[model samples]
Target: MYNKELIRNISIIAHIDHGKTTLVDRILEITSAIEQRKMHEQYLDTMDIERERGITIKATPVKVMYTADDGKTYEINIIDTPGHVDFSYEVSRSLAACEGAILLVDASQGVEAQTFANTYLALENDLEIIPVINKIDLPNANIQETISELEDLIGFTEEDCIKASGKTGEGVKEILKAIVDKIPAPSGDSGAPLKALIFDAEYDKYRGVIVHARIFEGTVRPGDKIMMFSSGETFEVTEVGIFTPELIPADSLSAGEVGYIIAGIKEVSSARIGDTITSADNPISEPLPGFREVKPMVYAGMFPGLPEYYGELRKALEKLKLNDPALVFEPENSPALGFGFRVGFLGLLHMDVVRERLEREFEIAVILTAPNVVYRVKMKNGEIVEITNPAKFPNDGEFEEVEEPYVELSIITPSEYMGNIIGFVTSEKRGEFKEVENAGKNRVVLKFIAPLSEIMFDFFDKLKAISRGFASMDYEIIGYRPSDLVKVTILVNKEVVDALSFIVHKDKEYAVAKKVVEKLKDLIPQHQFQIPIQAKSRGRIIARTDIKALRKDVLAKCYGGDITRKMKLLEKQREGKKRLREIGRVTIPQTAFLALLKIGEEDK
Candidate 1:
């Protein structure tokens, strides 16, 4: 049996591209977890999308055995988490499974918005934080400045911070030593009943659900009966294993151990993250304190490009949900786009990533509608309804008031771009400036309260353009506030396209409607008859554009004809065209729906 005192559970948290994965690579090398011939960069990032994007989307756990200077071997469990605000929930789940965390900061960039957000998450979880200055080998690395920011912002002393280069493996040994010496060993009673927290799970076609868990008390072995606390479903554990960065079969997993369990759970929803697992025969009276339910901030419709692929899309989403519990979807029907799911996401990037994964991984061509935020509407009869789809929203006279979601926005950028960022956020994005703080090293942190709908489309892209890619932002939904929000419906040839409808603020309704109608006019293919693209708001047509009909020259056949003959031919052609316009049905191409999602760029 392994000793509990020799095991350490820790996680590495940082901002995007702050070198968390690189640091994990160095640690794996120093500890000799994988053979030199088999090792590669970002070894823990097993997904193709992760490698291509150069970002970690999922939190990955790995186990490495290291020999300390005192000649004693120790088992270390490290969870490498994603840095984007959209995936901060992944970081929180990783933290819940660990006793300590390595707070990583970019040496040149100093403290960033996500760095602060992640640090606070760790603090909330009561994890021991060891500050690390990463990418120290760069010529522009300002280690001292970063260390100072860590001290002033996070209250970590100079000695508590470790300077390291993930590329050269410099100070890597110190990181390992700190994990063993500073971070406390896991505390649990092995003699008690089994109690493990399901931090994550994956689906294998042959093996079923492979649950990643951290054991807090007692022991679990093959053939033991386990039960999920939330679902009350019991299963016979078939095998237990540890991630030597890969699944390696183990005899048994005891208290203070981090590993996986294959319990023949065929249904993906049975093994939920944050659900407690314990002995089926001798169950715990109360479940462990689970994580807070994650509420999606942005919502959009995802439909298959081919109507026949709806079933395949559903299966793919089920499997993806097994891995990402943050994604929520439900079946919804649209008159224009057939049938699809209304999916909810944490942010715009999260929505994009899910769509890309659906296409690239599952090979399902998807059509995504314009993203929107959920709105609370109070009717004249005093009934409040939450609307996620614009087609379901009440008409102007039916609702007394409408409230939209807002977020607490934090931005960290250089002082030079502060004015431009402030002007854009306040004027264009409808953001209310809160305060500014000096973050040392000529950088400033700006705070704002912005409507989630305004930032859902192109806020981040515009921020990056104005700041020249130096600005980083993070936001959290701060309750709803009353707003003059109206639903803008799009029509092609006087037929409503439910999928193209979106909700917008009343003040900017005309501008947004004009943009959408104009974009649709260019995207929708011309038919035999004229197609009028119109945007409707508050029972009135606010903006309209026309796609000219395809015409055949009647004059070409009238060559050498007299003027009266030409006029008669022209009159006949006009009558036929008018009849065709009344009966012709315009088919809106799929590209038009996709293009309408990006109408915000025109405003920029």
Candidate 2:
């Protein structure tokens, strides 16, 4: 066991691509936590997706022993957190487990949107912030400018900011020393009842659920009976361990320490993130304050390519939920796509990541429908219903009012792109201009209140193109507001395809409907009979198109026959074609569903 007074719990926080993972690599090397031969870039990022994307998706914790200049060994726990706004919940949970944070800023890029958001989160948690300017080795790096921005934004002086290069290990020692010297030690009674907060968890085929937790009081070891405070389920502890970047068996974990505990939990839902664990016999009267539940901002349907793989998809989703608690799904069926689940995600990026993981990690090829946001429908009877799927929306004259979700968007960009950005946001995106302010030298921050659906699909992509990839954005859901929203349904050969239905604003319904019908006309293969593709909205056909039939030469053999014989043959062929058109089915290919996702992209 190590001394609680000598232990410092800290987390590394920064915006996307600001070198948080690279900095952690340098820290691990200087502390001698891993052998030189075993060390690699992003050593703590165990997932292949994280490495391929070059971003941290999960908050990883590791313990390292460093001998300070005082000739004494100190135990330091470092939590590496994600910088994307979609994964802000991960950073918040990590902060709950640490006493301080290393706020890293890219010297060349200066302060972006997420930098300000994460710093405010740390301040709310009452954590000690160590400001560090990273990537100082780059030729375009402006260290003095970054320091001024940090002071103007967060009120940190030039002396408090440490200039470091994550690439060459410059000033790493100063960071380590600052962690040991400035951060406060964890204070708790080791003799009190056992209380550990479950910050994260993962599923294992052999060991079941392995829970990562931070101990607040008492000690936990193998053979002790523990209970989950939320579920009230009891189990005997089978193992206790710590991450030296990899799981290593430990004898025991006491208060003020972070480690993993295994209770042989076979059910994935039992060991939830933000759940509390304590001694079953001598449990604390009150549980520690847990994190607030996160609600998904976007919803999409995920159906397997083959129906037989439904069971496998279900099992895969259950195991993934053990690792990602933000993901939520429910069973639903579509006439066009068959059985599937409606999965909810934080944003478009979150949806893409989850879908990729499902395909790569679980080997499940899933067909995703177009994404949509939650809408509120107030019926004429004064009843309100929240709709995530277009098929569940009420028909016209049935609902008195419809409300859509709205967000408060913040964007930081160079001053030159401000005019174009504001024009695009207000004119094309239907956003209301809120205000604009100066962030630092040659940079400005723009704020807007926009409907979430307007920006859900391709808003970010357009912003990047207009700003030349220099702008960064962050948003929070403000509330729901009344909007003129209508549902657009697609019919292939006069049959409704539930998977092709979507919700759009009333003014843009004709444009969207026309695009969907025209795209389907090109994608749907030619059948034995002509097929009509129609888009319906508000009980009217706003757009229509047809796929030409593949015809056969029925009169080829009767070339020189008499006029009466040719007429008889022609009449007979016409009747057959008519009969076929009445019962023929149009097979909609999977590519058609994928093509619908790009409809909004074309408008841009």
Candidate 3:
């Protein structure tokens, strides 16, 4: 038992490509947390997808022993968080595992939107923020300017910043020592019932579900019957372990210790991120509720190209859910995309992780439909429905009113481009500016309130373009509004495909959605029957296009020496065709079906 003062827990937060993981790698190497020569750069990004993409999708926690100047050996738990906005929620939960955070501000980019987004949450949590200026080795590294930004954003002084080059071993040792000296110890009564906030959990085929949790109060050991405060499901702990970043068996985990526990639980959603775990026999009276149900801000239908891969599709999702509990998939039969699942995610990167994981891990090629946002609907009788799938949408006459999810967005950009960004956000994105503040002579921060549905597709792309790629944005769900929204439904062969449909605000630019549907038509090889693709709204058809069958293509002509390529192509097409739940004479893909339900698929 760590009686009074043996544990130090901290989380690292930074914007995308701001050297968060790189710093973590160096810390591990310097502290000997990793085996010599066994470690590589960004070693915390263990998954192939993460390393290849250079982003951390899943949060990883590592335990290291550091000796402080006060001559005390403290057990420090370091939690590495994702830097992208998509994993903001994940970052939020990971903070629950630590008492403090090391905020790395890129010297060149200075403080970014994601940095502001996460730091604000850290402040709300009342956690100490240890300011670190990373990438000091960059030729353009403005250490002085970044330190000033940190002082403004995080209430730290220029002299207090730890200037370090995570790439080179420069001044990184100070960060380790400062973590022990600067950050406060975790505060909670150990006598209380065991309460662990699960930031993340993964399934090991051999060990079952291993949950990574921060013990807020009390200790946990093997043979304890744990209940997920969220699911209310109980399971006996089979193993107790600590993070070597790879699980290492432990005798027990006490308060403030971040570690893993293996239970017999196999399914992923049962061990969701931000869910709390407590002893069922002696359950905590009040579990720490960290968040609302992780709602997918973005939704899309995933289909295998071949109808034969329907089983493969399920297997892929099952395996993905093992590692990615945030990915929600339901066996959805779409008219256009065929056997597809209406998959939900926290944001765009989260969605991308699922898709990329599916393709890379399963070696299964898939053609995914365009993403759409959830819509809020209210009946005259006051019935509220949050629709994730457009296929489940009620017609206009069937609804008293409808609205979409809205978010309060904050953008930090160069002052030179503020005018351009503001105009584009208001005009092209249906955004209403709330405030604009002078961040510095060359920088400004603009805050706006807009619908989440608007930014789901290419919102960042447009923001980057209008600002000449210098702007950074962050957003949080504010509330729901009566969206002047419409459904863009696509029909092939005059039949609606449910997967191709989605909901969107009517006032925003429809050019992106319009182009996506056109691209879908181009990618989808038509059958013997000429399939007519049409976009509709409220059961009224709006936009129309046709997918003409490719001429002079045969399996026999392409089968020599590259059967795998031919099979993959046909498999994708076959999967799409299967989604065409025969509605009368039309055979539609699920993409067409779901696409039809969003605004662009529908006409004005």
Candidate 4:
């Protein structure tokens, strides 16, 4: 019953919306793991948020028993990994669990920003890359051009590539066959001390920390003492499970197969993604290698719609933390916004996903501040400090040394937008434009190395606008360099609010400061009394804004309703009003308050 030499461990990877999930669905259908009568599309990305957003946020593992033409049942463990650049760490984490990857390219879109981003991750892991051109049968499909680009960009030979329409199940069997041929067999000894690389793990009410890892060496059975390297945790393996496309009870999983280990560890840190799981006694010499810490690239302040909902917000975050280990939050007090949380994320996409999940999954309405890149600045005393919130900065004269993280970015767009992109980048005082290459007669590629802080927000929106939605962009973190930057703090009623501040390059500080004050003035409603809006730097107010008095309003008019009905409506308005932090006796609506906190100006 065991055929170790024939098993294939592979992961399917691609850009967002590039059909990696669809391809997985087709593979499951062909292998008959999924009952045909109720077969669906994008089966692997089962989260409701994923389906609604059409992006994969978490990686899932499935197993299919395929009967090859030689009449042999080969167990193929296929892992469906997240496809977005924000989750590149997830990609790297899951890649360690597989021997090969199917890099799916959109037939018409060719090599997109995310496709290149994830492909580079696969290459770095030294996994065999199987090129697959998907959606071959679409009306706008440009298979020939995409094939040529794949050869040029990723160095994949035409003969080594597979073509398939995941929608109609065309060429589905061929892709499956390629996995069996291209990926390597499991080679570690089952007798050696058990070691596995944890790709994804979660906690269950009944099962404790359920870890999904690929057995690299040795075998583990029930009642085995397991230690997780990441958390320095030790717990006895209570149960072993296998994939029936879903977790099922198993006696043990041998080397090269993906399985789950349930231990009595309760904390989430015990089974962290990308951590190593090994035996406690008969201890492994070394933990499974290739572990890297995840860092949060974006920072923001999260507040409740009302002060009474602060407890509700905490519960939502705690629940979300159960699923998203990458999210980090700490209690932060803002003079203007009152008590809130300063949250961190891997990047913008990661931040957006967390926000969307909070709103959609928890049904908690929140006030989110503008995201800023974390900065490492050296003070006048020559000591380096990591700064996230702009309010943490000292007076400009006190800082003699400063450095900001930079990134090398690649952007591809239609030829017509090339000039606009170049001008926009140069004008914004961000990255230095290196060069532009002609991909074809109508397509152009541009490269730039920029300060991460400069392009934190509006870059995506601006790029899409210039390219008419045809540009795809990607970025990688480069080392930091010294920068001449300053902090511009916004003051409402001559009072500085830590949440209403930002860091900017020296040359552009005044302009950005003006915009910030003006936008805040527009968003912050007229107060009961006149209020002053000003931007200050080094104790000097750089810009000023005044909010006029709140002149008029009609009280609730419930003529015919019962006392309970009137009271309920009044309660709603009262609750909404109470949630608004009264800064010097002025009420702020939730929507305008969030807008004033962001970086970019509103649309005209």
Candidate 5:
């Protein structure tokens, strides 16, 4: 067994673009985890998209050996987590596997919206937080003010905070010393029954699935049979290892140590995140608590641009799902778009990243339909149903009430922009103000309770635009509330396009429908016959637009002829136009459906 006193398991948490990965780079270099010649920027970020986008989409685990000022050695396992709100679940899982965390705050930007959310999550897990002020070398650095904000927000004094820059590696040694001096060693019973928490997992082609876990109570080794408490699936471990930048084989992983278990499992889905592992032969009576399955909050349909690539898209999704259990999909068919899958995501950013990965990594171009939020429908018969797509929404007579998810939203902005922010939130977005308080000299925090559906679509972008990029917001799913909801259906030439239908609040239906029809009018090409685009609610037409047909050149052939002959030619032309109208079809472009994304942007 290993000494729990010398092992420190910690995770790095921060807001987006707060330099978490950069700090990890400096740490690896100072600890000699990699040779100087092999060192590079963002070494732990393994994906090319991550490097290009400058965001960590996945949480990575690594181990390093550091010698402290006390002349003693310590084994530090650093779990780097994603900073975006879309990947908050990743942060939750990483926190479960660590005893302490380094709360990295941008020195100039101060604490952002996501920073507050993630800090609360870490505190909920009972992890000791080491407040670190990062990016101090930048010209706009406001170290003193940021430190004061931290003192107020988390009771961190100047002495408790570390000031450093990820760019020049300033204060790297001191930060390392602080980690050893301030953060407590991990605590666990090595002799107790096996209970390891699987924080992350990956699929390996040659060796099957590899699970990254932290041993909580007992020792785990090769040849030991382990059971996943959540799935109740058991398997024999083929190997045990730890990451030193790369995987290094280990004889065993005892309590308070972070490492990996390689089992001969065929799929990664069998080994899920946040699940507890225990020795099957010497099992624990109960598994560790706080484990819940990840649920998706956003839904959209993805259709292959080319109908022939349907099979390829299916295979790619299966492969991607093996690595991401949170991504759920099922076969969906649309009359306008063809066969595809209705995919679910944790949020909009998650949906974008998955789409990028599919197109860039798998080389498949796909069309995405309008996004929908889950709704709870109460039927007159006293039955409740959950619907994610408007195509499945029941008739008005069938449902007595519709309830949509709501969120507790918090916004941080400068005092000067408070008026604009409040006006937009209350008047256009239907937000209910809770309270407001001053965060610092010129910064204010606004709290509101708004429909999750309203904020889920382009709310952040608009907030930033209106505030001139000085505002940041965060939200948590509160619960479902009754709404004045109606289903808006779009019909093309009298045929309903399921992909173009959606549910909206009844008050905003007219404006939303008007914008959609106007955009569709410009996107659909002209046809031989008039094509009418209509939006309907409860079998009543609410908005309409028609694409006029192109004129025929029937008069070009009649140069000089009798009046009767010219009239006959004109009649024949009219007959031809009627025939064309009978058979003409309107092909809606894929870009037309993209207009639905900006339907609410024109509200103000």
Candidate 6:
């Protein structure tokens, strides 16, 4: 029942620390969406970690009403998206719900790595770009330089850029007016078959899965039977609601609208982001385009600290999975760590976020093993296998060829640190340099074709360290490439521990093995007898260390004893040592496994 011309659906996109959340706060204030006394800084950032880190971790959507000077009231829907490269999927999904995007750039810092990455995504979604410069009130604000960068990198001219400060509340009104004047309203047929794009969803114990979607065509109402285009599952719509910063029940949602639909879906997996929703009775023949599934880029084993809590962890994972469909996990058992789950994530940050949520939300402490990526192995018998866990890797000569994932990586950093970065990526990480170009004054963009395995570790931290925290990066999977990779097994007292095994490039096997053995030697407590720590790959020992024994001086009090008696005592002590060695089991502490995350830290 609303005119498309009076509605504006837009998303705010920017880099981390670029004040996207603050801008949203300013907009809410100007729109009077919330009372002045009730407003707080970063009002859109609902998570504690988000506020603490000053970053938007989740994409949040809200509705605001603004009365223009032209004596017209407009309904604006703003989707505030996270800017970190790790949350690129979330940003992309949020962008899909909008017809235009406000690209907020830091006035002093200009365009960053994520800025370019997110701008490209918005362009990919065919969203109109409204370039805005934020934090212009700062003393170091280089408005001209930032404008130059925008023009050079994103092809935005000076006339297209708007300057604003969320802190001082300057130019905010102009920005909103621009949204009403410049950004095009969503255009769709409200009478067509129902077609809604599911941008996000959440699980509620009482209401089940609440799907956040954008209506592209037709209208949806409560009690209407809805069907998911991808899953082809139908459920009666229980409720339709919109975010007026709070959930408000609505009679119906029409085309060019962003709202939530509850369809009695208990499992989060049933409602996937990027999936299309349609009416069950008159479903569309084809779903919306760009419906790609999210695939995990990293895999790791998560084991409960207490073995008895495995069941509790499983239930927690199931509950969390309802909200996060990107998370994939399966039951796995480890000889050293006992029962655990092999969880897959979009990236390392996703893994960390999931782990944090597990501990904080579920109150379950878990020990994680070294992360790994899937590898394609061609067996000697001509069968191909994809392995996620190193314990499942084939032995040497058992596989004819091994292939590992590769990526096309792009990094933006200051020109002063370019040489060191090139060396770090090409030599230390085994990446091949593709090209380099000027980004702006004293800034450069470097491209490389590298193994995904390298970036999966501490590559980002290393890059940041070398660049003095100014470097930004983004990457895309470039498919699998054949490589000389091996599964390195760690043995304690001649017993292989599946949890400690990991896949490594064959060239760095010896170095990685040496580091692991060294770390384990320091972490493992001294046994009654010497416990040999060995790293073996392809049935050949690559490195070894021993946790020395804590020997008792059994012969100390034998001053008055005969030589034969002393000798017998010594013989008995030797016998005890032999027996202990034969039956001894070394308990590897969790810290040893955590040391794997510090792979290159010592060198740095």
**lDDT of every model, 2 decimals:** 0.88, 0.88, 0.78, 0.79, 0.87, 0.87
Clash pairs of candidate 2? Answer: none
Residue 532 CA error for candidate 1 (Å)? 3.2
Instruction: Tell me how far candidate 2 lies from the true structure as C-alpha RMSD in angstroms.
Output: 2.9
Taking the tens digit of each residue's C-alpha lDDT, what string does model 6 give over 1-604? 4777788999999988998899999999989999899899999887777898788877788999899989989989998898777777788889988999999999988888888888998999899999999999999999998998888788889999989998889989989999999889888998999999998888899999999999999999999999999888999998998997777889999999888999899788889888999999999999887777888878888999899999999999988888788889999987667899999988887888888888988899988876888889999999989898888998898889999999989999999999999999999888999999888788899999998888877788899999999898988787999998888888889998876777788778888889888888887789888899998998898899888789888888887957998889878988998898998777777666667435522221
Q: In candidate 6, list every pair of residues with a backbone clash.
A: none
What does candidate 4's lDDT look like per residue over 469-584, in tens digits? 88998888887888887787776765566666777777776777787778777887675567777888766877787777553332346668577886677566655544442545
lDDT of 2 at 488: 86
lDDT of 5 by residue, 433-512 (tens): 89987666678889999998888767888899999998999888888999999988898887788777778889988888
Model 2: lowest-lDDT 10 consecutive positions:
595-604
Q: TM-score, each model?
A: 0.92, 0.92, 0.86, 0.89, 0.95, 0.94
The candidate with the higher lDDT, 1 or 5, is 1
Worst 10 residues of 6 by lDDT: 595-604
Better of 1 and 3 by TM-score: 1
Give the per-residue lDDT of model 1 (tens digit) for 439-518. Answer: 76678889999998877667788899999988989887789999988888888889888777777777888998998898
Q: How far is candidate 3 from the true structure (C-alpha RMSD, Å)?
A: 9.2
Q: Report the error of model 1 at residue 373, Å.
A: 2.8
